[model samples]
Structure formats: structure tokens, C-alpha cells
Target: MRTYVVGSGVTKVDRHYERNYLSLINEAVNKALADSGLDISDIEYLVVSSAFTDSILNQVDPSTYIAQNLGFRKTRALTVSSGEVSGAVALDYAHALIRSGKARKVLVVGFEKMSEYPSWIINRVYSKILEHEIEGIKNVSPPEYAAMIMQEYVRRYGVSREDIVKWSIKMHENAVKNPYAQLQFNISLDLLNRALRISEPITMLDSHPIGDGAAALLVTDESITKKMNGALIEVVDIESSVNLPIYLRDDITYFSSTAAAYKKISSKNEIRLDKTVAVNVYDTYDIYGLLIIEALEICGRGEALKCLDEMPYLNIGGGLKARGHPVGATPLYQVHELRELMSGSSWVKYDGEISLAHSMSGPDNNAWLILLRRWV
Candidate 1:
């Protein structure tokens, strides 16, 4: 019965074509209630994270049309569509409505617009979030079922092609210092040999574009963070796993909800995943960001492409492959790119307290993992 994340916000993940979806959910929900100094009447509950739609904005219960266009009278709006981890299922339903006493303040939002259609109509609405009557309605999508499980994990783990283009060139050099990244340029390896393959071994530069924005968080509990302070992050542990659908998984090549968020974040954080300093999963396809570093066992099986030149803060927010996979607002921009890369300076090349954010939905039935730390 605990949770904290005082405040968060994000918006620039491109293709917003001058804002829509209720002004990108009222500019990332009023900059996450103005970064949680708070006062949208101290938000009660709103937890949206629904996605994919845009026939001139068909508002099919978009969290009660963004809580009746933000007037929010008497709060309590919900949505949480579990695909693309509908923003980590609306931040695990606002951390279970503030640990179940039933709200002390919760506002997690996660909208998406997908450039208002036509990329063959949002890739057929991202193939209706898979399991399309037995895997992609018989035409196959989700980048041809993740390019046939990344061409059988690069032919049963012999993986190469410079270890599969080194995680799209290290997530575009971590999205070039991530200004709310939506593909913040930077890519080479000979321009990925003229990419644009689309589904051979997946490319167009390893996918994750056509993104629209909105990400937010407010979460509360430590008695509303002792009457609100600046930068705090807690969410000690949160785990979720639901699999067995891609033609009933037995072993459809890993992703039992990323091995159940790596066995529930290593049994509720005894500490592992190479003593996490940084690692945001759900790479929005660079072959599941190299099978989520061997499904979060942190490397072993197929040795996650030679442990990506020794994992120095992998993903570092350039995850969701250069931070644009705005599906269900991308798990609230993975807690707004790991709370803006672990709130302010701590230089010295490592240890930003602790961090890990994972999210998924459908195909990997529905997965979630979040474990931040840093409060001191």
C-alpha cells in the first residue's frame, strides 16, 4: 500500500500536426498539474491511457472525453485499454487507486493520435493489437509478427549483422539527448544500408514512428508526498503479467510478458538486472529491443547481442526506439523518460538511484514492470 511519483509530464513526441486529442490532453494534463506543485483541485482520479483513433477524432469514450474536456467535475475517469500497455495500463491503474484506500490523488494520462491516419490507416490500427483471430487475421502484421520473431531470433541465436544493428544504433544515440524524443535523428552504419525493408528483418530504421504525443503522471500516497515537494520518485515495485494468446503460447520465443517482468522485478527488488542503474524495456521493436535483453534475465540466452557493448545505461530513454512509440502514450513516456532521466544531476557515469520501466500489451498478452527508486 504505497506509491509516490509526485509529478511528471511530457509532450514532444512528434506528428502532433498542431495538437488534437483534446489538445493533447490539455497539454499533457496541464504539465502534470504544473509538475505536481498541485492544484487542479488536487486531482482525485483520472487514469486514462487509451489509444488509436482518428476519423476526425471519434471520441468513443476517450476517458469520458478527457474528463469532459478537462472540466473534470468530480473526477474519476478511467480508460486503460491494455494494448501497447495502454500506458502501463494507466500506470497500473494509478497504482491501484493509490494503494486501494481509493485515491489520495491519481492522474496518470496517456493519449495518442497517430498522425491522424493514413499509413494504410494507421497500419490497420496496428493490426488490431494482435491475436487477430489467430495471429494477424491471416495476413500478419505487428511488423509481420515482429518479423517472425526477429527471423527466429536471428536464426536460433547465432545473431549478427553487427548484432542486429546494435539496437538501432544505440537508440539513436539515446535519442540525441532526448528532448521528448520522437526520433531525434542520428543514425549511421552506412545509413543502415539504405533501410526501408519494412518486414524482412524489419526496418525503416527498426520502426517506431507515426507517433503523436501526451504523457503524464501525478501519483500519490506517502501522505501526498508530505504535502508536495519537488522531484520525488518511488513506486517501489509494480508488476503485472498476462500471456498465452499468440496461438496459445508454449514458447513463441520468449515474452511471457517479458518473462513476467523478469520474475516480478526480481522478487520485488532484492536487486538484480545487473544492479539496475538504467534499463527501460519495451523498445517498440528493435526485435523487442533485442528480446528485452534476454527477457530481462539481463543477458544469457543468445546473450542479448553480446550484451550491447556492455550495457551502459541501456535505453537511457531512447527506448521505445528513439522514444516515439506513442502507443497508448507509451507507458506514460516510460514515466516521462525515467522521470526526466532521474531528476537532476548526479554525474560520475552511473547510479541514478535505480530505474527500470517495462510495458507491453496484447501479443505479449499484457505486461508491466515499473520499479523506480530515488527519493533521497
Candidate 2:
């Protein structure tokens, strides 16, 4: 059995002050269903991915709540929460169900609502995603970790800070054309230099913004593809791995989990990195984006900045830096954007058959790599 993504949809990545969780989910799911020309009744399973429903929304069993609200009377619903990688985890579940002969059609919805709370409260919740008892209590946040990694990368690689700033400028420029992106305006190196410092060597401009958003993907077996006229993007392979916490790791600049997952996928699939036209990486911070490129072996270690200009296909959707990292919903957005780009429906034009999406939890404590091929 083979799994194919028949359709996908995403809501604008922004502070949805007027929309609630159910409303956002409904909008994304409905758009996906409409794109596939399949009704909600056609879906056999519902996989919901979220990270803060319990802590922020005070809602328990959010999958059940979403099922009940969405009129999924017979469809089995499951929830997946793996910090920031929840979306990719949920997608893995959906793929398994179809490939294992359990279901013909599966709907994966990833969402996060974070703008309703204050920055202090949101920051506290974000810290909980780390090794809570250890790193959480130390007052070290994600930005600080990113700063440590960035500083070390510069020291060891001899990459200039100006080169890193170019990544942000490129992302913002790409986002300017992406209607769903949160930060859709162009940025300048001078402006970034003047931006407020979040940590040493990391300014607010380099970090992804917190916002509310949702994305949905409809995964179905090959049998269902015959009946649908929409573009089909095959789920070539999905691989994931876990590593020790950043504190336990020997190198702060390397992402072992991401490397492990990439290696697994490479062994199973004959994917050519040079031929892959688009790659969506977990760019919660600029340094993480650069690190992912090296970890995936797209470029040699510490060579990302040097090879940055050579890799023009990276983060065409603006990445999390400008597209907005709504935590659990982010991976789904990557998948959705790749689907659009591969199908030639996106603002950015790329004529390629393969695309890769990368997502991670914390500073690469856990990471997932999804390979997608455009079906001709």
C-alpha cells in the first residue's frame, strides 16, 4: 500500500484574535476537503496535533473535542503531542494507518493557539517543552539555546554574523509573496542590527514569532487517488529519531537527532539532494535553520553559510522565521507549502518532483524528516 497526499490547506499565520480553535480547525480542514473534492464523511480517521491545548486552553482530550465538534461520528480520532514536532508525528500516524491497511483516507490537522496569553506566560509554557526538571528550572529559553549554538557556530566555522543575517533577509523577502505568512515584509541587515536583542548575538529579528494558525493535509491510499482529480504528492518516506538533551550532547552546534533521521531516510530512499527543488526546515531560529542544512548533509558541516547562496530552494515559503511557527501546526504548513510549490500553484515557481520537510522538538531533541514526491 502507498500513501499519497491528495490535498492540503492552511490558514494565515497570524494572531487570530477573532477566531477560536474550532473555527481555525474547521477553516483549514474544510479547505482541504474542498480541494480534494471529498466531504468530511469521506475521511476515515482524524489525527489532531497540538502542544498547548491542555496547558493553555484548559481542554482535555482535544482530539475527542475536535471530533465531536466536527461531526466525526464514526471516524476514529487520535491526538499527538511531541512539543514542536507534533505535526510531523501526527502525519507519521496518518501515513501508518493508510500503509497498514487500516484506513483508506486519513485527515491530519495541526494547530496551535498562542496569542491569547501574555508573553511571560507564553514563554513559561515554551520552556516546559525542554527537559522540564533540568533545563526548564534553569531559566534558559529556546532563544538562549539558539544563541549559544549560533555563537559556537560562528567561532568554529568562521561564519560572519552578516552571513547569518542574510538568511533572515531572504526569508522575509520570500514571505512577502506568501499570503499565509505572518511576517510578509522585507527586512534589512541594518534593521536587524538595530533590533532588540533577545540574547547575546541573537536579536528578535532572528527568532520566529508566536502566533495562532492551523494547517491540514489529506492523506489517502493509491486506490483513492484514482477517483480524485487533484494533484497527488506521494509520501515517499518519513523518518524520525531522538537524541539526548542539548545539555547532555557533546557538541552544541550539531543536531544529532536531525542527522540520524536524515541518514535513515537516505538509506531507504534514492533521493538526490541536488534535484530536490524545495526544502522546508525547522527555522524557529536562524541558527537552527543553518544547522538543519548541515545536519541533513545538504551542505558539509559548518559550510551552510558559505553554501547559502548556492542553495536557492531552501525555505521558499519564508520558513518559520517569517511564516510563523505555530508550534504543532508548523510541519503541516511545510507539507502544505511543498505540495503547492510542487504542483506549480504557489507564488514561488519551482519545477521539481521531490521536496523535503524537516521538523524538530526543542533544540533537536527529537526530529522528523518527511520526503514527498510529486506524482505525475
Candidate 3:
């Protein structure tokens, strides 16, 4: 049995002050169902992914309410949350269900609403992604962790701060062409330098913005694909790995979880970066995005910044930086963007058959890599 993504829908990453969580989910889900040429009745399962539902929404067992809101009375529904990688984790679960002969069609929805909360509260929630016993108790936040990594990376690789700034600038430029991106305006070196500092060497522009958004994908087995018209994107392989917390890791600059997941996928199928149409990486912070490219072996260690010009397809959707990191919804957004790009429906046109999406939890404590191939 093979799993394929037949349809996908994504909302623009923004504050979305007017819409509630249910409304956002409905919009994405309806669009996905429409695109797949399937009615709501066709879906047998629903997988919801969210990170801050408990803290932000004050809702527990979100899957139950979400299924009820979507009118999925009898559909088997569950929620998957693994910090920022919740979307990818949910996707992996849906893919497994189809491969295991459990279901023919699965609906995966990832959503997050962060703008409703104050910055202090949001930061406190995000800090919990760290090792709660150690880092969280000390109030260590993601940006602070990123600053440590960036400092070490610059020291180890001799990469200049200017080179890192260039990465954010390029991401903003890419977002200018992406209608769904949150920060859709091009940025300059001047603005980045002048931006308020979040931590030493990490300014506000270096981090992904707080936003609200939702994305949905309709995953179905090959049997359903036979009846669908046009090409479908196949889930070639989905692999994930876990690493010790950043405090336990010997090297702050390396993402062992990312490398481990990619290695597993590589053993199962040959991944040709040259043939890849686009690569979406988890760039909650600019430095982490650079580190992920290196972990994917797209470039040598510490060479990601230097080779940024060479990897034109990297983060064409503006990445988590400019595109917005709505936590659990981000990975789904990556897949949706890649699907559009492969089908030539994206604003940033690209002609290719393969794409890869990477997502990770805090500091690469857990990571997932999804390989997608266009089945024409």
C-alpha cells in the first residue's frame, strides 16, 4: 500500500484576528476536500496537529472538539503534538495508517493561533519546549538557545554575521512572491541591523513571527489515487529521530536528529538533492535554518551560508522566517507549498518532480523528514 497526497489547502500566515480556530480549520479542510474531488463523507480518519492548544486555547483533548466542529461524528480522530514538529508527526501517523491497511483516506490538519496571547505568555509557553526540568525552570527561551548556537557556529566556521543576515534578507525576498507568507515584504541589511535585539547577535528580524494559520492535506492510498484525475504527490518515505537535549549534546552547532532522520530515509530511497524541486526547512530562527541545510547534507558543515546562492530551491516559500512559523501548521504548509510548486500552480514557478520537507522540535530534540515525489 502506498500513501499519496491528493489535495492540500493552506491559509495565509498572519494574525487572522477575525477568524477563530474552528473557522480556520473549516476553511482549510473544505478547500482540501474540494481539491481532492471528495466530499466530507469520503474521509475516514482525521489527524489534528497543534502545539499550543492547551496553553493558548485552554482546550484539552482538542481532537474531540475539532472532530465535533468539523462534523466528523464517526471518523476516527486523534491529535499529534511534538512541540514544533507536530505537523510532521501527524503526517507520519496518517501515512502509516494508509500503509498498514487501516484506512483509504485520511485528513491531516495542522493549526495554531498565537497572536491572541501576549508575548510574555507566548514566550513562557515556547520555553517549555526546552528541557523543562533544566532549561525551562531557568527561563531559557528558544531565541536564547538559538543565540548560543549562532555564536558557536560563527566562531567554529568563521562565518560572518553579515552572511547570516543575508539568509533572512533572501527569505523575505522569497516571501514577497508568496501570497500566503506572513512577512511578504523584502527586507534590507539596514533594517536587520537596526531591529531590536532579541538576544546577543539575534535581532527580531532573525526570528520567525508569531502568527495564526492552518493547513490541510488529503492523504489517500493508491486505490483512491487511481480514481483521481491529474498527478498526485507520493509520500516516498517519512523518517524521524530523537536526540538528547541541546544541553546534553556535545556540539551546539550540529543537529543530530536531523542527520539521523535523513540517513534513515536515504537508506530506504536514494535522495538526489540535484533533482529536488524545492526544500523546506524549519527556520524558526535563521541560524537553525542554516544548520538544517547542513544537516541535510545539502552542503558541507558550516557551508550552508556560503552555498546559499547555490541552493536556489531552498525555502522558496520564504521558510518559517518570513512565511511564519505557526508551530504545528508549518510542516503542512511546507508540503502544501511544495505540492503547488511541483504542479506549477505556485507563484514562484518551478518545474521538478521531487521535494523534501523538514521539521523539528526545539533545538532538534526531535526531527522529521518527509520525501515527496510527483506521480505523474
lDDT of all predictions, in order shown? 0.76, 0.89, 0.89
When 1 and 3 are scored with TM-score, the better candidate is 3
Mind sharing the TM-score for model 2? Answer: 0.97
Error of 1 at 12 (Å): 28
TM-score of each model, paired residue for residue:
0.35, 0.97, 0.97
lDDT of 1 by residue, 1-376 (tens): 6888877777888887877877877888788888778877678888887666533266665888788877888888868776788787678778877888688888888877887867887887777787667666776677776777777777887776546777888888878777778888788777666888888778877777778888888888888788655567887777877877755666666886778767877876787776245778776778787776677788777778777878777777688778778788887777766776677632214547778888776446677888888776
Q: For candidate 3, write residues 1-376 as lDDT tens digits.
A: 9999999998889998899988988999999998999888888999999998998999876778988888887788889988999999899999999999999999999999998878888889878788878888888888998999999999999988767988898899899999989999988888866898999999987899999999999999999889877778998888999999888899989999999998998778976564144899999889998899888888889888777887778888999999999898999999998888887788766767789999998889899999999877
Q: How close is candidate 3 to the true structure, as a TM-score?
A: 0.97
Off by over 4 Å in 1: 1-4, 7-40, 43-50, 55-57, 60-64, 69-107, 111-123, 127-140, 159-216, 219-280, 283-289, 292-301, 305-326, 333-352, 358-372
Q: Could you tell which candidate, 1 or 2, scores higher by lDDT?
A: 2
RMSD of model 1, in Å?
17.1
Clashing pairs in 3: none
Alpha-carbon deviation at 123 in model 3, angstroms: 0.9
- Candidate 2 per-residue lDDT over residues 193-292, each given as its tens digit: 6898889899988899989999999999999899866557999889999989877889999998999998889888976575145899998889898899
